[model samples]
Target: MAKRKPAFVLGAILLSLSFVVSACGGTGNGNSPASPGASATASATASASPSQAAEETAIPSASAAAEGTRSYETDKGVVEIPAKPQRIVTDYYGGELLAVGANVIGVEPTAFDNPFLKDLLANTQDVGYPTNVEKVLELQPDLIVVMYDDSYEALSKIAPTVHIPYGTATNIYETVELFGDLVGAPDKAEAFIAEFEKRAAEGRERLKGVVDENATFGIYELTDKGELWTFGDNAGRGGQALYNALKLKMPEKNSNDNQTLQLSMELLPEYAADYMFLTVYDPEKKGEALENLQASAVWSNLDAVKNNHLFMNDFDTFYRYDPIAITEQIDLFVDMIVERTEANKK
Candidate 1:
């Protein structure tokens, strides 16, 4: 009797098979719409062999289609996508895609540095900062998930494309749920959200007890040009985790601003809070920026600086709006607030 492969081995084999088909340009004919700009010259190799042509022309196998795909309405339009896509190419939000267990095959270079995603994406392809359509075609993605509309037309030529609005103040939980739905992991998405909410609530409670009830928090980043930029909930930038989920108070002046503000160093006191979270745009300029800021009596007098409550955060880790990163940020926030509050008491 022949022995059956273990589940993990079989899964790996299936994944390899999917990659092969995608790399060779299997478009899942029935499941995907006609390529908007697919050229005959580009697809000639995909149809070279009769067997390959038949495979490309035939509809997705009913079983595979039923088990692995569904139609989704996106900003671009309604489109069919694999239920559990084996080869995914994402422009931004690779963190959210990874959080939902999607098999990401490609992402922008920026995502390559993300601490949580870096190791996982070691073998993933760099699809270019603006996305190289030719490279994307070579990867043969089952789905192309993008945050920008600019790359949609080019990517749609290679495979099914879906657009999720990025740079909006969309709640992280809602975005996670949407990603879950897109990747066919709605249950997992909901579970993660529930866990996040529970943890956030716990963190908020902990902070309330350790810190002054009226104490406020602010997050800022120093640009390469030595400018200060304050973040808001418009995009996460740790704001959602701190101000929204953890219920950390923000200064009244900043409470209503939904977008990031570029403030001069002299105006630091106006937006200063009891505790400050800082990040740098360019690490090369960090030392100089810190030196310049510290040299200023104005910056020295701010409560956060005077109280020694300024915390420096990594740019890739803290600036992300994805659920995985947000959850991690929340954990860091709780620890910092608790430790600082305790130290201040001493």
Candidate 2:
């Protein structure tokens, strides 16, 4: 979400969360989620996909439409997908599949880079960016999950194609449970939820003293174009960890019912919080703009910034919010927040 014009680009590619969080708080075990979901009960319009805005119901799959396949309801149309998809190809939502123990044969190149899901996708084929449609056909996947409908006609002709859309996957657990139903893995989905909650609860205990009840947080990115990009809960950029899993809060003034907001830097004071997470977008390529801002008086004087409550995060590391991604994020995120806050206090 760097160098983006406010009205034009909502944000960047969301993050992928992949590490496993265990009930006993032991590290290891399992993996990543991405593409956001809905938990705020915000209107469908508020949670529309960043790229395409269509229906708000958000894609959902259900019971037998055919002898071997089931009906998956999407905003575009009802697709008949396999009751148990054996060969799956996903882009951002691959983490959701992994959480439910679904067999994902292929994913876009980005999924392979996801630390949380990378090991799990060790053997998974790289489907290419813009989703190499040709590579997908060769993979002979039984089902395809996408964030958009651009290749719907082509992909659907080859096999059942379901659109989950971006921004719509904000409700992390709800969306994962829905994916479990979509893949006929309800039991696995339940277990994912159980373990994630247990782990997150443990994380909350860690933040008890560091984060108080009224403390507010903000997920922000200083775009190269001089815009302030703000994100909602579970909308990636560590949102799942800070706002959802650890149960932190975003300032109501800057927060809205939707997934993103790109506003002027002058509004920083209004959006200021007790603590802040700031990302420089794609720093290597677009960091000059942020450097200029950091030198400005406005940037130096923000409440959070002056108070040493500002923390930096890489754009890609914190973009994913799948069950797997969020689970992996808890311990790491908790430790980072605690360590950073403690250091600043000293």
Candidate 3:
């Protein structure tokens, strides 16, 4: 059995899912049973800053208010979202909301969702993965968000929808800023980034003291078809951030061949790298692809494999690229790899 590509490969699958537009109103006056936490009297006090006001134009079609944040008046309805939204509904990128001090109204069901969103989930509705417009409408979200292209249309119909377009090659920072401005939470966004940068700096400080900076890491997916799919700078995947943001090294053996290569199972041995990042095709289904890779002779024999340096990560969280999430993610990655690599040397 071959190894599957990185978790970002699911981007292709989600892209194939159907998307639709929705019908809605400007203000949701009548409360549904599942509506988000009511807008408190303090809701009117939520305002934006001067810098936030100046940059409001960049947010997608959203208009700035006197308070500094932006609002959207779409054909479906009007959304007076905060300059930085406090209540956020998401498909897979709900982690971004946490970074910005916002409350998570919903998230895609997954392990990452559980730890970060456990308390919020009790009251939050499951609009379903990629977002269910019907549930979104009932939830009366301040902002409806999705990470894939699949849920765009239906989400837009339900409310003021924002697409994160998560994948391997996507720039996480740019995606983060876009969301930041849209929700009128640029300050919170900036704060999260600062914290992330601090962690990244600490990682870099540690790395610079000892090992060679030019050392490379290889990311690949082993497939049943005997293929070795290597991810590159432009490849949309969660691991791509480690390269793009942290400036991590990539193995020389992993060439510029960013395309998913169909290798014979015999060649899986040749594709093994110094450090491997593992991902499965459809984790929602059978774990066969992953299991096969673990059991393969070629996989067991690799230097990285022998040393136990391969890193396993969550697909849904990693694949969705957002600035806040990206920083948080790479920090974790750097620490994990650095700790593992050092431990192996000992």
Who is ahead in lDDT, 1 or 2?
Answer: 2
Show model 3 residue runs off by greater than 4 Å: 1-8, 11-87, 110-123, 147-158, 162-169, 223-228, 233-241, 253-272, 281-301, 306-325
Runs in model 1 deviating more than 4 A are 1-65
Error of 1 at 202 (Å): 2.8
What overall lDDT, based on C-alpha atoms, would model 1 receive against the true structure? Answer: 0.62
Q: Give the TM-score ranking, best first.
A: 2, 1, 3
RMSD of 3: 11.1
Winner on lDDT (1 vs 3)? 1
Query: Clashes in model 1: which pairs?
Result: 68-83, 69-83
lDDT score for candidate 3 against the true structure: 0.49
Cα shift from native, residue 290, model 1 (Å): 2.4
Q: Is candidate 2 or candidate 3 better by lDDT?
A: 2
lDDT of 3 by residue, 117-216 (tens): 3443465556666456677677766667665557667666665676544441123343334445556556544544444445556667766754457556
What are the clash counts of all predictions, listed in order?
A: 2, 21, 33
| Best-performing candidate as measured by lDDT | 2
